[model samples]
Target: MGKITEFSEFAEAVKIANELVAQSAVAISARKMGHRALTVHAKPSASFAPGPSQEKIAAALAPNASLLKEDPLPGPATPIHDAVLARPSRLATPAPKGSQAAKDGIYRGDKLANALYAMCQRGGFSGALIVDDNGLPLAVHQSPVPEEAIGAFAIVLGTALAKAGKLLGQHNAENISIDINYTEKIVLRRFMLGQSPGYLLVICPQEVDERGEVELSIEQIAQILKRA
Candidate 1:
């Protein structure tokens, strides 16, 4: 009976750890994709006082910060997603050409097409794309985004996001969801797959209050990727 309690505790710990890995993956992906919404609310640099240097204060407090310490003891083995998230800096690094990990981490070809198609068919979303870490599309479903231009768009947007985060010192961003009020409302959501640096971009019309459905569908797609 005592052992059963221990087993339950262990199971609970594992579950929490998995959740952390998943969140970390999303954060890494968000950073890589250059999600701008995450930093939209950050206090402007111009607002800082012209007093003592912020750098000095940070340096003085550095030693006491937990993040400044050596890496913690190894946790559960990191899968591709966790590994990519573990090194937040990797998002800024150039992807190696011909590297198998980058190629294989998220299976290519229409692997994600069906899921994306289903999501788009649910209504509101105009299109969807499952993109790899490098912004190359693995699957594109009904997106007006031209197949030839997807990669370039991803790279440009990601670079912008990373630059903004760095300037604001908000290096960890989980995902980017933005609603643009144009002639027609447009919603854009960008999030990472749980097992890789891969990303999912969903673009939808803001009409008809379909935000909840869109969110649920994206989450369902993430779960499916985790099991894949």
Candidate 2:
């Protein structure tokens, strides 16, 4: 579903957030009211907590938020848990020099090798490479499938990431999530370049099992790229 632009008040946003944070037993009033923005926060911790930045945005809307007045977003010193979940994160390690690494070449065998290991545990599909946005290999763990097929899979995944960036309006696509199908697996992919450009994050699961696990793994790998 596309964005819902309803609900014109900060009170509405807060009301929805409170209900979600509580794990309310009923469909939220905001959902009933069809408040799109408010409904987004209907899940626990999904609401963007109000800190200075959020407070600033809220103040521009309603005078203030009750939750914000009492509590706030994680302070600067607060240790962030999942880096991916953070709205504004400056903690990622940089990938490399401005131009030391080729922007369009080199396979990321380091990361792919690990992903391959996990997929192999379940007799998963042939492994495909993860490549940067520019079609450079960031990593490659060979799938049990024919070696000749790997390049095409990588390229196809790479193309998907490039198109997705434009669709999402993000500088880089975020992560490779998993959505399983029994006989054949459905792989959700993402690409991000820390130093140069992002590469594909390929996922082949026995079946669609874990979304959170996939997200966490992608973030960990992305962090590695940031420092490389």
| Top model number, lDDT | 1
C-alpha RMSD by candidate, in order = 24.0, 22.4
Q: What lDDT score goes with residue 211 in model 2?
A: 48
Which run of 10 residues does model 2 get worst, by summed lDDT? 39-48
lDDT of 1: 0.46
Writing each residue's lDDT as its tens digit, candidate 1 over 1-228 gives 577647878889888878998777534443444322211111111111112233433432355533224322123332122221233210122235777525654332333555665665555355556655555555665443233243334444555556667887766653454443331232434566655555566654444344666667677767766665
lDDT (Cα atoms) of all candidates against the true structure:
0.46, 0.41
Native RMSD of candidate 1 (Å) = 24.0
lDDT (Cα, tens digit) per residue for candidate 2, span 1-228: 334545456668878878876887456464444421210111112111112233333343243534334433234433222221333321222335554333533223434445533433333333334545433444444322222233334444555656777887764664443332233333545644645545444434344343454555566667656656
Q: 28 in model 1: Cα distance from truth in Å?
A: 41
TM-scores of all candidate predictions against the true structure: 0.42, 0.37
